[model samples]
Target: MTAPTLFHVAILRTLLIVAALVALESNRLEAAAPEPTQKIASAAAAFLDTLDDTQRGKVSFAFNDAAQRIRWSNLPVSMAEHRGLRMGDLKANQRDAVMNLLATTLSKMGYEKVVGIVESDEVLRKQSPKGAPPFGRDEYFISFLGKPSATEPWMIQFGGHHLALNITIAGEQGVLTPSLIAVQPAKFTLDGKTIRPMGRETDKALELVQALTDEQRKQAILGSQMRDLVLGPGHDGETIQPEGLKTSTLNEAQRKLLLELIAEWSGIIHDTAATAKLNEIKANLADTWFAWSGPLEAGKAYFRIQGPTVIIEYAPQRLGGDVTMHIHSMFRDPTNDYGKKFAGK
Candidate 1:
């Protein structure tokens, strides 16, 4: 072969080799993505099976891994509205047993926060709109990536109507923030009781905004209140910016309030690990932005706190089937988007 021709062939070979390496890495990353429901669904089903016949009876006829994708509206966990999978279904004693089951599952998953929120939900569900189902009655699906457990690295996600919790344990350097928590009240009544769900989380956020000396309010409030969470379902992993609120301008009091606001938000997590994540968010609070829109009232308003540590959003919507008020909220982590297992950054 000619000398020039030989050099050209070598160049082509190098390009092919580079392309091949890129393709291989891309495929590997794709495979590393998380798969939650399928992995834990069987175990969830088995756990349900282990329940005594009486306990199983408390579960909605529709409850099970197979029913993971039911229409959000057709939720079965709400008892009075859908008339299934509720505390009433369980004898008082069995209710605690049910908690035990959930706790076991979380331990098996290597995190108790999973059950912590469940317990919190149980409280909220009791206060669900009369003639309606449990709050966040939608399925609690579990997903996973590589099984690093709490030891190596892994992610487990549990979400529904008003809750979005993602725990990414990447060795000891893990992140459970960027978490989301939401609650809704129909007409502001709870569990046939008049309690308010999320009232504290919401109140604290506004209190912090209000405490901001008048000038700080102008920066923190960020225009008008929103009618709904600006970033909704399909908008997942999409962040909004030049980010209206920044922690840069705030008084010592306002900064403390910011931590207070985050504290209220993080209080929902039932696990120490989740709480530790909240504290990290608190520690990084100054690096985050607190933004709210609309009237910060019980009716017709929305808010969000987005920063390096966590993203919390609150929205009000028309009640489903009943006239009670509605709310949709979520918490997402900065580094934990999708899952950090394969996310090299």
Candidate 2:
């Protein structure tokens, strides 16, 4: 071949720069400890060690138990009656250990968000009528599916009214899906500061919707009005025909907003797993879809982000007097909910 020209040299230099950037991103995603799986497994085992035989028997379940896998809801404990060790029944130290395990499993913001959801229940409890269903942070329950192990598949089920966190762990992987995160009186005061449990979720969604062009907005809005989540609790192992504006059609700026919106849910898991899961979602962003229902400018609305590996929905409850005050949302992976892909279930 003839000697390379100046144009060829310039092209080669540009390609090398792009390759370096790709390698840098890959390293960032893989930078966590070799195994967050082991850390979480150990924390779980430590939590179990704090329990007595009776507590252990009540808190543990067969990993593949179909019923337990689907036994989570957004209703209050008095109405739905969750299975597992009630946080209210645990000793103070045991409760602390439970919190420790939760902190270990979720990202810092995620842990704060989960705590805020639980605390929001207390706020609702005070405002609820005397005959309303019971509500309180203490009513939350925690259970383990199968024994905690670094190399084996298992899960953590923790939830109460308006919250359900189903985290599955297998090896270096962590999964959070089929989770129900809701809150009544969505805004409240805690320690003289305002706390909105699902604040980022709502704000980011609205920002993304508003950023779209009028034509794009038309494509994003669904044909039907969605008053509540279509794939909320009890709708496990279900798939819906993808609807709304395809991510492929979005401009670069709009797509970035979409990923930020997705991170509000997927980022709740531990950093190691969340980074990997996000990278996976980003890789498939072109195939994802974003659907919205109800108001496009503000107030209460419903939105969804769906892709090959993930499904997320946010809906404001209509039963509550002010729709904005009560919100219900879901995050799920159609292919890997409960880590079934890793567990071979």
Candidate 3:
């Protein structure tokens, strides 16, 4: 039998959140000495115990019994209001503790992406809200992992409004790749500088598309009329036919640029885990594909990068009110998403 768990209430809750986000087997968890969820749950509980009641509630996962130790959900793309509770609403110490809890669990789960996110969070906290803060204030969500480790991939669901970062780390040497990152700024202007939330993604994608010759471009643009990013959340590697672009169609230079474009965004984690994935992508460089739709300019557009395992897509959504062109982009591995994607022959 397992040792009686030793953790505080909030920590237990948070660990459970991570556990729910991740799919795990108890037997496997026990084999990994200390256990991921148990360890993370212990750490999170310690953190919650350190918090005041108000602070605990602020950063707590707002959900019902559906909130399991490994299935707590929180990452919503739209910037909706009343995203349960928020760490932003917590006190300074409490907020720090909340973030610290996340970072610590990330490390335990063998996901290094949180290091950069942790550092970025500090900077964001200090920097004045970028213009209108991209999306609504209450558009973010938070979930934790009760137990997470390389053996069992557990994650924390936290995003919304101008944010999307679903971190899932599992297996012996798996790294943390933020599943989604999106933002819609009312307009660019951060500290007098033109600042776009995903300028890097836009510029790189545009550059790669422009690099294609007239003939090569046509080969990729299967459709003429532009619309939305066909490959949205519900459609993860759905169409088996491999529509849009193919890397083989491009010349040597164009192909290299395609790699660079995708790599640029993947570089966000800035950790060993990212490097490992990078090496794998580099090896599979040849058998990849790149596709785009709409005018090369920055209005409405859609682009996709697909490889044997890696797939990244970007598209500008309709913005009727304020944002004339919004962005929706994502990266996923066919067989490695959340380390659990089924494909029956």
Which residue pairs collide in model 2, if any? none
Which is the leading candidate under TM-score?
2
Name the runs in model 3 displaced over 4 angstroms. 1-85, 98-138, 148-152, 171-178, 321-325, 341-345
By summed lDDT, the worst window of 10 consecutive residues in model 2 runs over 26-35
lDDT tens digits by residue: candidate 3, 1-345: 765465666788998988976655554555664344454445556656766776555455422222332232223323234333465555566556556655554433222333323333333434436553433333345654323343444555555543455555444343333365454442344456554546656777777878877887887776755556554444644644466656777778876687777765565542455566777787776777777777777545677777777777776666534323356667677766544431111
Model 2 regions more than 4 Å off: 1-33
Q: TM-score of predicted model 2?
A: 0.88
Greater lDDT among 2 and 3 belongs to 2
- Decreasing lDDT order of the candidates: 2, 3, 1
Model 1 lDDT tens row, 137-209? 3345333334323233444344544544454444333344444444444324334645455555556766776
lDDT of each: 0.51, 0.89, 0.54
Pitting candidate 1 against candidate 2, the one with the higher lDDT is 2
Residues 1-345, candidate 2, lDDT per residue (tens digit)?
899999999999999999999998765544542567777877898999999999999999999988988899988887886999999999998999999999999999899999999898999888889998888889999999988877778999999999999999876778998788888879999999999988988888999999999999899998546557878888888888999999899998998899998999999999988999999999999899999988764548888899999999998887778888889899999999998888888
User: What's the CA error at residue 295 for candidate 3, in Å?
Assistant: 0.6
TM-score, candidate number 3: 0.65
Better of 2 and 3 by TM-score: 2
Q: How close to the true structure is residue 303 of candidate 2, measured as C-alpha lDDT? A: 88
